[model samples]
Target: MQIRDLPYTDPGDPDVRSGPRFLIWLGRNQIRGQLKSLSWGLLHQCSIAGLPLVIGFAVQAVVDRSGNRLALSGGLIAVLGVLIAVGDTMLHRTAITNWITAAARVQQLLARKTAELGSALTRQVAAGEVVAVSTGDVEKIGWFVEALSRFAAAAVALVIICVGLVVYLPSLGVLVALAMPVLALGVLPFLPRATRRADFQREKAGKATELASDTVAGLRVLRGIGGEELFLGRYRRASQEVRKAAVRSAQMWSLISAIQVLLPGVLLISLVTYGAALARDGKIDVGQLVTVYSAATLLLFPLRHVEEIAMAYSFSRPSAQRAVRVLSLSRVARPSTVDAAPTGDLYDPATGLMAPEGLFTAVVCGDPDEAGRLADRLGGHAQPAVSQEGAVEEGATDHEVPSVLLGGVPLDELELDAARTAVLVQDKDPVLLSGTLRELLDVPSSGRVTAEDALSAAQCDDVLNALAQASVDSGGDPMDTRITERGRSLSGGQRQRLALARSLVTDPEALVLDEPTSAVDSHTEARVAAGIKALRKNRTTVAFASSPLLLDLADRVALVHRGTVVAVGTHRELLRGEPRYRAVVTRETDDEIPAPAPPGKDEAIHAIDTIEEIEERA
Candidate 1:
């Protein structure tokens, strides 16, 4: 496809069997563009090669003192120059277009794969590796793709020059033909070493990048724990390692480059020296000597292209392999053939937990970690559980784990889009992408709730006020305030509320929220809980929280202990009837017994006291 047509509507299914195969697949897909680039490149190189011959004829004409031959040679020079200019310009344009379009296609494929895998992609691949592949590796792969046509044109031009010399003056022509191969092949022996060093450097760089990303993401937490220096030291070591690897890699490539320059220079010097002897011996004239010298000199240019092709492949082969690894990752072996979308209660057979349709359910787990896992499982993206010995737990493999079902159909059995539309799970820490507030909130939604209504239901008046104040100097609207990456500029509580508002706007059939108010104060948490209950009235919602403020608002509460639901009833009933549930929710000890207050009275008093403390602090 042409550059203008890029950003392919579909990048098409890639052959990811191996790195070489993947590179070949990319080439085959862009054959039209490659061929166009090749044609221009051939014209450009051929015109350059023709210049030396035309100049040789001009020299001959001057020696013969023939005005007609001189004039014709001058005309040929002008024509060749024009062809050179046009061919070079178009060749460059087409080659660059090939490069940019190839990179775009790879990026599009990476983005599509990322979307398909979702959170599981990061779990399978290192965040640093993903960053490296999508950014630096993409350019390397594109370089090789664009270099292919140029290299081919250069090779063909070299062949033509050699053949012309052999036919015109066999003595020097044979030497040139034989030595060209030597100059070209001399660098091959060093390529493997250079390639290894390059791969090592890339690996080191990826680790360093990943470390830096993680360090920056947790900089606040690291400072709070007085461990920022420790991470900084580790990162410093990683950076040093990357530097060392890069230097070693550069040293090897420098050796190859030296050989490329040295061999060609030697050949040129030999040809000029030998041709001068032929002219002195009366075997060939001054014009023939000049032609021999010029051909040898011009041959150096195409020889460099040969080295470039080698270098390009060395760098890009590993990059293509990395890309292949990432693209090969599949959340499922195959797409679900079942087109029917299921609806009803969300049920996890593994946990024996059922969140009935059109009801608000709260799950209380003795282990908060388990609650998070349950949330993922309910959304059909469950990760394998690791045993204490660091091995994957049996029967918890991705393919083996029991699927969560809705209306008797397995969630994983339905098309991905259909399943995602039916259920939405917001984990404890939902990231806020960097953009204006309006852009951040403009997600796919059911249109049942407006952005303003969702924001109000999320009790985001303070957040709006803060954003407006921040944007006042810029004279922009409150909704136009730009958030920092991952919403790092906002307080944790503000970020949580905004994420909640976004989720509310989506208005999914089943919404699962994990500790949505974990970062907020009791007063705000209470309002958020009440708002959620009111807004989600007659909709299916599952909230995994232990706060009495949130639990009291649940239509029903399920108590989970040791990975299975043990009790299901109203919050107050479970609190009174199940000791384990009470201990988990209240942080009470089994040995402690106290006089009970009136039913639901304790919760009301607790909520009132928490609100009073929050107001006093404010």
Candidate 2:
């Protein structure tokens, strides 16, 4: 984005500067939209310049007191007032629009970056910091951009006023001009202190926000364990720190504000003292003396923005810094140096795994987290960690996948849309967006598949019935019923079922599902397992699950331990041959009791419960 075109808000950026490069980075990210906003904003600032000038000219004319000239000055004064008012309104509106859009664009960029980074993002940065950047920091960066435009217009106006006063009033103007910079910039001395305090306040604020988000996200578990008050107390202490920081910040601002008022006030008095002395000595005209003071008085208005710009920059710098951290993350694997997409089955040579063309497969991972990470790598949600040496591991790649071949081409090598069409990872905790049944299921872009078919496959006939019942109770069609945020309105099983159903409707060629049946009761899960197996018979489906029922249905299963596929076989074959695999999959014995204490079993810390517990009459 050539930010130069949007002169007012667009801070002119050097090619590479740590502090301001971030703003330029944003510009490059959304060059076209910002270029348009910049074009409109400069026009706005140009209009704003008229405000101070009009005031200066009007005061000058009043001091002159000539009949025709006075009337002409009066008319100019009226026009100037109208122009400043109109300009302020329009310029502010345009600049604000640019600010909002820029923030939104940056948000989108961060989201896309997060998606690309996927599991790597968690490893690279704190989850809270990521949340803070996306939610709070992006807007501050946008604010700084918007402030740039306003400061530019005010700076120009200040310069024009000083030059005009010098031209019109000579020596008196000299004193006024000299005083203008000193007064306008007098707030600088207090800035360092203010910035430090403001930064402290912002840090406290971010910590508070992160704490609150964590508390809310884990509210269910927190309440269960009686940890609510502990977090609440921590938050309270953090808030108190924030309050203290805020008071310190406000104190420093009060000092800066005082200087803003006092420095110029001092200058105005000094200018009047000198101008009045000259007038008394008949060295300067009374009218000129009056004009000088008036101009000096007008100086205060523009100076306010100088202070404003400084403060805005103070807040935005840290925000920009945070945003920069997020934007700086590059995909580990770079796309191949070729335009043509590959044509063949996707082969993870490390694991001797081939996602053969258009076929359903199941990955029975022992570790759920490892399973999730592997799914991300396979579906192109993550750039594979590069490892080139004597040793290599499964599901890791140093190069981007080719795009054209669907799975044949690396998903990352293809254009975003093409890759997404070929592979869709339905997260185990599929987010059920708050909406009606119809809108939730309606994947508008590809409407080829019907809701009935997807619902059948997902075994969501019961979910639809429940929704319809809820709707009827609430006086609306079940299809139009509202789903609450996080789908708290629905049970875990219901939400998962709905999410699964929604994914089924899209029917992408490669569908990666993680523990898709973990929430639903075994009976419902059995139906879903059977249904998904039948419906996704031809499509390339990889179900990341350890459920015995789901495992039985898969053509084959890979037992992933740590980050590698340690075992893969039919259920019975693995059970009979792989000792570790059998222990993990069938820990429950004939009586449903887990294996009796194996001495030196420090690794199995968790108490494994099974049908044996119930059978023992406990």
Candidate 3:
């Protein structure tokens, strides 16, 4: 495929069985490109190898002083030169095309897998590892694929040179032929050591990369906790380990490179030395000696490719394995193999937490992990790691956490598109892509809610105003304002509000929000809860939170403890009756500082006059 025609019309299904198998699959999918590259590479290498023969003829013609010999030799030289130029140019063109196309294909596959897995990807694979695989690993895979075709052509050329030498100068040919194989095979023993070191280097590098990614993502938190230096030290140690591994790997490969050069040099010396003797004995003429010597020199070119191909494979093997690891991850929770979205109640058999249709339900789980897992199952995303037996603890009163049921049908049974559209789950740490506000809010919508309505309902007026003020353009419109990645430029409260607004815009049948208002103030939290209740009117909305304001707004509040819902009642009833519920939900409020005494009459008059002056100035 041409570079411009990239992203293949049909990238074809990739084989995720194994790393090597996946590489083979990539090759098979691009067989036509590979063949074209191979043919061009063969012609190019063969043309170079044929050069010695042409030069030999030219040398013989000069020696003979025969009629029109110079002209004939000159014509032959021109023709060979043309073939050499054309072959080299086309070979390079095709090789590059193959490399780019292969990389593009791998990148496309990675992107598709990322989209399919969604947030589950980071849970299954390290964020740094995923970043490394999608970026650096892709290039390594493509490098190997491009090199394989050229290696094949080089092998063919090496054989042709060996055969030609033996046919024309039998004595010298035998030595050179045997020596060529030795030159190619001599480095095989060192390869294992090199490959092992490379693997070590890659492992260390991945860890270091992951550490760096985590450090950057949590820089603000680290600073807040005065742990920035601690994380920096950890990253420094990781980087140092990676450096040591890379040096060791380089040392091994350097030895192999030395061997590659040394063996080929020895072979060249042998051919020259032996060919001289044959010429002296008249068994081979001077021209034949020149041809054999020149062919030996040319053979070095292809011999280098042997080392190159070995190195490419060594590096790419691990990279391909990393890519395969990511691609092989399939959602363990299969929907009920059905195509339609089920209706009615959303039930988690394992936790026995049921949110009946058309109600705003709040689940308060002390353990965040348990709460997150329950949210996943409620959204039909429980991974297979939660074993069937783990569905409900053995002998527990709760029913087995089999596939959650939406209405009466298994949630996992519905088609992915239908199921995803039917139920939307907003994670606690939602991402805001780098784009205009309009694009950020433009999600699959039922057209029942507009962006303005969603934003207002989510108590995002201040967020919109903040974004508008941050806009580079003079229009200062939030819809036109650009948000930085993950909304890093925005405050924590602003990002949370914006995420809620985006979720509201989707207008799904049911929405599951995890700690949707944890970052907002008490007043904003209450407003958001009330807004959500009003907007989602008569639709199922489950908010996993322990905030009193949010829980108070829920039509029904469920207390989840030790992985199961222990109690269910109205927010006020739960607070009055359930001590655990009151303690968990009111813990934040209890820590809050008491209100200060009201200002004195003189101070109040001064504050009022100051406010009036400020209003007049505005």
lDDT of each: 0.86, 0.69, 0.84
Clashing pairs in 1: none
- In lDDT terms, which candidate is top? 1
State how far residue 51 of model 2 sits from its true place (Å). Answer: 9.6
After superposition, candidate 3 runs with Cα above 4 Å error: 333-336, 385-401, 588-618
Better of 2 and 3 by lDDT: 3
Looking at model 2, which ten-residue stretch has the lowest summed lDDT? 384-393
* TM-score attained by model 3: 0.90
CA lDDT for candidate 3: 0.84
Candidate 3 per-residue lDDT, tens place, 330-446, comes to: 554343478877679888878898999999999999888888878877887664522222342222234335877788777767877877888889988888888999999998999
Q: Give candidate 2's TM-score.
A: 0.81
The order of the candidates by lDDT, greatest first, is 1, 3, 2
Query: In model 1, which runs have C-alpha deviations exceeding 4 angstroms?
Result: 383-399, 473-476, 593-618
- Candidate 3, clashing residue pairs? 335-412, 335-413, 336-412, 336-413, 337-413, 338-413, 350-401
* Error of model 2, residue 87, in angstroms: 2.9
